[model samples]
Target: MIYFVYQILPHNCRSVRSILCSSLFLQKKGKKGAKAVEEEPVQVDAKDRIDFDSAKQKLQAVVDRFAKYANDAKLGKTSPKVFDNLMVQTDHGDQPYTSLAQTSIKGRNFIMTVYDPANIQRIINSVLGSGLNLNPVVDPSNKLTLKMPLPPITTELKNESVKELKNVYEKLRNGASLGKNHTLSSIRADARHKLTKNKKLDNLETEVWNEYEKLHKIYVSKLSEMIKAAETAIMK
Candidate 1:
C-alpha cells in the first residue's frame, strides 16, 4: 500500500500539494517475493527562525546616520565649505567649483577670485545655475572678480530651501524602504526553503514587518520635523 504525506507551508511557499508525496511504495518482486517498504518522518529544526533583533539593529544604524545629516542641515548658514563639491560645467567637462576659483567671505558676501579672466562668464553661469539662488555679478574695476551677495531670507528663498529638503528626505526614505523590503524577502525565502510550518513562519513575518514599519514611521516623522524646523530657521 502507498501512503501520501503533506507538510504545512508558510506564506509565499509552494502550494499545499507541492510537498505531497508517497512515503511508502510497493517494491517489485525479483525471483522470490515482494519486499516491504519502510517509511521515515521528516523533522524540522527548531532553531531555524528569523533574527529580528539583528535586523532591527541594522535598520537603526541607517537611521542614526541620516539623523546626523539632518541635524547638520537644520541651521541655515552660508559658509565657504558649502561650495566644496559644487560641480561646474566647463569646456573640458564638469569640474569642482573650488578648483576653478578661490572663495572668500566679505561680511555677508562671497568674493570669488577666478584663476583666468576668460572663465569669468563661465563661473557666473555656474553660480546662477547652481540652484543656490545666489546672483553673481562682475566687479566693475576687476574683470576677474565676481561679487555675490547673500540675500536676506525671503519667502521665496525659504520655499526653495524646503523643496530641496523634501527631495533629500524622499531619497533617504526610499533607500531605507528598499533595504527593509530586501531583507524581509530574504527571510521569507529562507523559511520557505526549510519548509517551515505556516503558523510559526507567518507569525514571525508579521512581527518583522511590524517592526520595520514602526522604524520607518519613526525615522520618516523625525526627518519631516527637522525639515519644517529648517524652514522656520530660514525665515528667522
Candidate 2:
C-alpha cells in the first residue's frame, strides 16, 4: 500500500495515476513498476538548508570561543573525576565550565549544534581576566630587587631643574679643570677661596644659590646707592 502511493503519476494533484501505474496494479497489467518506492529526486526545502547552515555557523563560533576560554581553574573543580573528563575538552589554564556539558547530547554534537552568542562573549571576557598579572623581580636572585614608582615633580621645580641640568653638565665638563664640578665637596672648596663674599647666582641647576637670591637682591638694593656716593667722596 505504501509502495503503491509513492509510484503515483505526478501529472495531477496527488499523482495518484503515476503511483498506481507504477505499483502492483501495473504489474497485473503487464507493466513492471520501479523497484523502489522512494525517489532520490525529492525537492529539499530551502528554509531547512538555510536554517541548518545558519545553526552550524553559530555553533562553530561558540565552540571556538569555548576553546579560547580554556584555562586550568575550571578543570580543578571539587569533583576530581569530572575534572579528569572535562579537562580533555580544553587546553591549559583554568577553563571555565560550559553549558554544553549540561545538554543530553554528546560533547561534540553540543560543540556543533550549540548557539550562545552572549555566553561566548562572556567566555571571552572570562579568558581575558583569567590570565595572571605577573610581577617578576628585576633580579630574582639578588634577594633585594625592588621597583618603586618615582615621585611626581612639581611644575615649577621641574622647569627650574631642567634649565639647571644643562649648566650642571657644562660645569662638570669645563669646571673639571678648576676642580669645580659643583658637587658638595667642590662647592665647599671653592667657598674657601673667599673670606666673606656674597653667594653668587651662578649654576642655574644648583638650588643652594637660589635659596640666597632674595637676600642678595635686598643687599644689592640697600647698599648700591651708598657705596657709589662714598666712592665719589674718596675720588674727589
Candidate 3:
C-alpha cells in the first residue's frame, strides 16, 4: 500500500497546498519476508510560509537603531593615533610648540598649532588653498588653532593593509589548529617567512610603504605652505 502526504501552509495569510511526497511506500519486505509499515515526515518550504512584510519591517527597525547608535556615538570617527603629529621647533631659549590646541571639530579631533597668532588667518587660508578641510577656532585660554583632517588616502591604505594582515594571521591560526605541535609564535614566524615569498603580501607591504612616503611628503608640503603663509601674513 502507498500513501501521499500534502501539507497546507499559510502564505501571507493565504492557504497554499505544499506537496511533500507524491507517493510514500508503506509496505516493505522484512527480514523473514513479512510486511513492514514505514512512515516519513512531511517537508514544507519555510520561506513560502514566512510573512515577508513583517520580516522586512523588523529588519528595517534594527537597521534604524544601528544607524542611530553610529551617529550618536561618533563611531565613524577615526582614532587619534592614526593622525601624524605636526611638530614645530623654535629658536634657542624658546620652548618648542608641540601643539597649539587639542580640540574636536565636527566629531573629529586634531592637534592644532600656529607659529604666530597674527598670521592665523593666513595659515587657515593656506590650508584651505591646499585643498584640505579645516576649522579654525580661537579660545581665550589657548592660542589660535586650526583643526585638520587626516589624510584620507593614507589612512584608507593603512586600514586596508591592517585588515589584510589580520586575515592572514587568522589563516595562520586556523592552520595551526590542525596540529597540536604548532604554537602561535612558531606559526607567526612561519607566516613571516612565507610572507617574504608571497607575492600578494609583498605587494601589499610595498603599497603601504609607498603610501607612508606619500603621506610624509604631503605633511611636509602642507607644513611648509602654512609656515610660508604665516611668515607672509606677519610681514603684512
| Most lDDT-accurate candidate | 1
Candidate RMSDs in order: 16.0, 39.1, 24.1
Q: What's the lDDT for all of these models?
A: 0.62, 0.32, 0.41
| Weakest ten-residue segment in model 3 by summed lDDT | 68-77
Q: Candidate 1 — which residues are off by over 4 angstroms?
A: 1-96, 102-106, 113-121, 125-146, 174-201
Please give each candidate's TM-score: 0.48, 0.16, 0.22
- State the displacement of the C-alpha of residue 123, model 1, in Å, after optimal TM-score superposition: 2.0
Expressed as tens digits, the lDDT of each residue in 21-132 for candidate 1 is: 3434322333224234446785544343445465555545555655555554443336555667778788899888888899888888888898987778888888878777
Q: Pick the candidate with the highest TM-score.
A: 1
What 10-residue stretch in candidate 1 is worst by lDDT? 25-34
Across 112-190, the per-residue lDDT of candidate 3 in tens digits comes to 5565676556544444543334444454455666665544435454444344433433333333533533423343334
lDDT of 2 at 1: 41
Ordered from best to worst TM-score, the candidate numbers read 1, 3, 2
Worst 10 contiguous positions by lDDT, candidate 2: 71-80
